[model samples]
Target: MENKRTEISDLGEFGLIDRISQNFTSVNNETELGIGDDAAVLNSLGSRIIVTSDMLLEGVHFDLSFTPLQHLGYKAVAVNVSDVAAMNAIPKQITVNLGLSNRFSVEAVDEFYKGVKAACDNYKVDLIGGDTTSSMSGLVISVTAIGMVGQDKITKRSGAKEKDVICVTGDLGAAFIGLQILEREKQVFMANPDMQPQLDKYDYIVQRQLKPEARMGVVHELAELDIVPSSMIDISDGLASELLHLSRQSGMGMKIYEDKLPIDKQTYDTAVELGIDPTTAALNGGEDYELLFTVSMDDMEKLKKHADIHFIGYVQSSDKGNIMATKGGNEVEVTAQGWSHFKKP
Candidate 1:
């Protein structure tokens, strides 16, 4: 049977908002008001609130050729939550604004919202409120995540002290490798319409690019263990770039061991297959959504046995400079090569 197609014009703007509003229920008590009103209300959870907003452009931020609507929706919310998690805060609510072109149908919007709703449930955040408007070009998603953290629990990039241990949660470079695979598949399909994408071998990396989770688990674990990171930042623009940001902000230098960088087996093999260095991918690959943080040496023993956390380096005095100790025992100046929005492709 053919699926029914409903146009946005059929339901109109108010009707579409109503349809989307029904799919999400407020999960956070702080979300005193969600949807239906001109504004959403939130009960202050803490003395400090951390707010972060991220915008996703269809062509620049993501390629719809290989991205599913559901995955895109989930990714939109997850990426925003990642920023909040980086501050060592618990995300409470998110407001999603979408600009849709005529090409998007009512069912297409519903499919997108299903993924958003799934992400909200998984992250334990409430969909508060947002605006829906028409667009002349492509689908645009802007998400603002609101989170709360106590003054003492809040983490920043500038808190690192000399000799602080640099730790990273989860493996890196899978997302970049996933993008390579996706682009390769897209080109192959474009060249031949009959060819189907063979992606079983690349499933891990592909999924990493499609649907990434914020490191809220790691944050909760640190709290449970009564361990607070001296500094923290999410690994969105790759390890090397984020490290530079921390160094610059904290007025300190860093020394990271190349051999200590975590890379998944699949990511390593795929990078080699693609004629790219695995270390390069780990350093410069963007969109990992992992957390890179620093803990005082005194607290090292508490997290030393963590299975998911990898100690990659240590903070150094400003005179030492940002450097990476290679596997061959040579130190090289760390460079920032992460994603730059202004760079022309």
Candidate 2:
């Protein structure tokens, strides 16, 4: 059976907006008004609002060759929500803007929105509004997420104090390793059309690359435990990169033990199979979407039993510098060699 493909011109811009708006309804109390208006309105009540915007370009942020439109849409929202989670905030609303080329059909757009809708439901956020425009280039997605946090609960990268314990949620390096497997499979498929890519064994890492979840549960759990991080940043970049961010912003040094770094068995074994050090992957691999944070020694006991969180290190004076004590009993300065969109050739 042949699939139906409706052109975007069949609906026009406003018609397309109307079509997209029909599928989404605001579920957030803060969202006083949503789609079909000049601008969405929000009622923040007394909480401080945190806004974050992220843009995903076609070839730069993702490759559509093996990436599904649905997963891409879900990822677009997840990355932005991860930013909100890093601030210790509750995501309330999101506005997704898209630039679609004529090559994209209405059905294709629908598939993408299905993923977006799934994410909105999972995160308990409302899809308020967004813009759809024609594009000469491929698909472009820009997501802006709005979250709420009480003044006392808000966390920032610069709030870490000396002696505070460094912690990370979930694991690291899986996403980076996943990307490698994807690219490798893509190459194999390209070289031999008949070759089926062996991806069943790499399911976890592949999903980490394709559909990452924002660590909102951790944020909620922290609130329930009455523990607030002194400093926090989502591990969108590598762990080392985010650590450097905390060090530079907090005006403190970090000392993390290599053995303390968390790594999944699959991520570690796969890294070894690929001849890449799992520790290096955890250190410099980007897009983990995990939370890297710090808590004072006083609050550390509260999280001591948390299964997902790992105590990796502690904050120190700037003179001591950012160092990672190796399992071999050696110290080395941490460096940021993670993802860079604009790197000099």
Cα RMSD of all models vs. native, in order, equals: 1.2, 1.1
Per-residue lDDT of model 2, residues 1-345, tens digit only: 029899989988788888888888888899999987889999999999999999999998999998899999999999999999999999999999999998899989998998899999999889998999889999999999999999999999999999999999999999999999999999999999999999999999999999999999999999999999999999988999999999999999999999999999999999999999999999999999999999999889999999999999999999999999999999999999976888887
Query: Which residue pairs collide in model 1, if any?
Result: none
Give lDDT tens digits, candidate 1, residues 75-129: 9999999999999999999999999999888888998899999999999999999
Off by over 4 Å in 2: none
Candidate 1 weakest ten by summed lDDT: 1-10
Per-model CA lDDT versus the true structure: 0.94, 0.94
Question: In order, how many clashes per candidate?
Answer: 0, 0
Query: For every model shown, what is its TM-score relative to the native structure?
Result: 0.98, 0.98
Cα deviation in Å at residue 269, candidate 1? 0.3
